[model samples]
Target: MNKLNHDQLLSLEHPFVKIPVEKFRSSLRTSQKHIEKEIGNLTDKISEISKKSVQGSMEPSQVEAALEAIVNRLSTLKRKLKDIRADEVLYSQRTKVRLQHLQDFATIQTLDSDEYARWSRVRLNRIVIDYMLRDGFRGPAALLAKSEHIEDFVDIELFAQSAKVEEALERQSCAECLQWCKENNSNLKKIKSTLEFSLREQEFIELARERRSQEAIAYAKKHLTPWQETHMKEISHVMGLLAFPPETKCHPYKRLYDKSRWNDLIAQFRSNNFALQFFTPEPLLNVTLQAGLSSLKTPMCYQPEHRNANCPVCDPETLGALAMDLPLSHHFNSSIVCRISGQIMNEDNLPMALPNGYVYSYNALTEMASLNDGKVTCPRTGAVFNLTDVKKVFIS
Candidate 1:
């Protein structure tokens, strides 16, 4: 005892004493008897009063007095039982305290164990689905009276249940849940308007998601959600839509990178590897053109530019860029100065000067070019790398 810590010694005052089941049984029985006796007395008084009224022998004032007396007696009986309950709690303070601690330990033990925690959480959540099944929730009979941690447990438990409720709200196809609600009105017998409101809100949320992907993308360019972005990349990868080599892409860079590339290059002027220029355009036409620009034989024959900025080979422009190092975009839009270069010419004949003179010119890469007839404008110097070749660089 001397060696016991504060908690153990404190626990000793109540000593883990178990409340006898018989005592609870007796208390319950007594409570029931008290209520029954009051009810029986009222029933007898009403019977007598009714008889007197039917016989036309009782005065209205007298009858009212008698009824008031019965109501007063009933109120007194209720007050007496309440007092008795209070007295019992006071007299059995030690037992009450210990039992409450026991209840808390039971609750904590049920939750603390990883195995039972999920199950117990599930059971508590059922209250949301089974509110009508709750036994006595208002006063002392509620969970709060029995356990110290009831509030915390309930808050966590409520949060867990809210997800299910939100799902119940969000589902577009709520036929099953609605049917269940009809049969078991306990959880969902609320005002008609509330349910309708919940359903509409969820439907709107779903519609917005659809609009962003399918419709809004056409008007404005934006980064796609991870899933859509991944899918696009996969398609490009499968179709053999590859970017042009640096020198060619610049005119190789000009052939590759774009106006945006120039902006990003200027933005990072002080950086070590200042890009002469950067350009990312779209992917090249994967399909073999019926007539190569080189093969065309006419009075300066050229296939007019397609309305869409898409790669003639690939529908969407494949990412293509030109800079000192690897180009930034499939179109070659994003870029950073990887190294120094002399000049940059785009797929067309436009040449852009590098921001920094030391490495003033971007790789005047002549990657993509067209001749009014068969012009060999852009040329490739280093070994041309295939798509499969670069895949090894960034696989993951």
Candidate 2:
């Protein structure tokens, strides 16, 4: 048999011929445990010695010996702690080397020019900054802006206010968000948002949950009653909740007491706030990740030997079928297809506007006309129309 060198034996376990991080960590933990046990025993002996000294049963020699032992154990613990710190530094260095190796393996050269790279960096920076601000990382956003010298582009005050509003909402207090809504009352009213009323409703529920039914009723009469015209059903439902005890487990009314209501209100407030600010509801990073994932799900992305290799291309033909698989709310109103034919409007299949203003693909309208003997009816409004009245809508 051939004898293996030290380096060869080490390389068999670790590619870099270094101790694994897990083993190093385990050794550190074991050393720490031993040191801790020794310190704990020394502490117990010191406590006993102090008690004996207090009772005048311990001699001076006994106290001196106990003190010496404690000092020696503490010195050993200090040395162990220093060794642990050194090991941590080593682990960090090793981690960097491993990361570099992985990066080298996964490296791919972009075919784009330097300008494209520059533009990508700028876009990525903006997305990260927006994500930071949107997620209530004002301090980090500010620091990043200052570092990148883009402080002029970032509205620090606005981000700070947004952070405050988010924090208040997280704590189940809508004071900050309500104040923002009050300041932008005119704009909110223009959008026909019920954010203010919803916040008041949450406060009323909170009051009711605290067993202050009288105060909750008063709050409803003062604040919630005005919105009765617009939200009568919701108002009635909430008013009915007042009849039962705060701790009532009644069917529909019981949902009013759930903590999730606060979360829902918070989400609604955030959505309304984003609308008022003319910002997208989702962070750019989140939207980018979703789009990337959706793209990756395409059949073209699969390898020839992959399980989904025979999957159909993600084209218009398959879009309607895929749309059915997705949640209804996931489809934007502007992007939603005809309810009857399930086809999107394109150049070839132009959008046809009926008398009721409901638009459908021209192909769908033609089919409807053929079926109804040239009399087309809007599926949504049930309004009747003729082929002459169905005009093509040119959407840019």
What are the TM-scores, per candidate, against the unseen true structure? 0.21, 0.47
Please list the residue runs of candidate 1 whose C-alpha ends up more than 4 Å from where it truly belongs after superposition: 1-22, 87-396
Q: For residues 54-76, what per-residue lDDT tens digits would candidate 1 score against the true structure?
A: 99889999999999999899888
- Candidate 2, run of 10 with poorest lDDT: 8-17
Q: Give lDDT tens digits, candidate 2, residues 52-136.
A: 9999998999899889988888898788878777766665565555444434323423425454355446446656887888777
Residue 170 accuracy (lDDT) in model 2: 81
Best by TM-score: 2
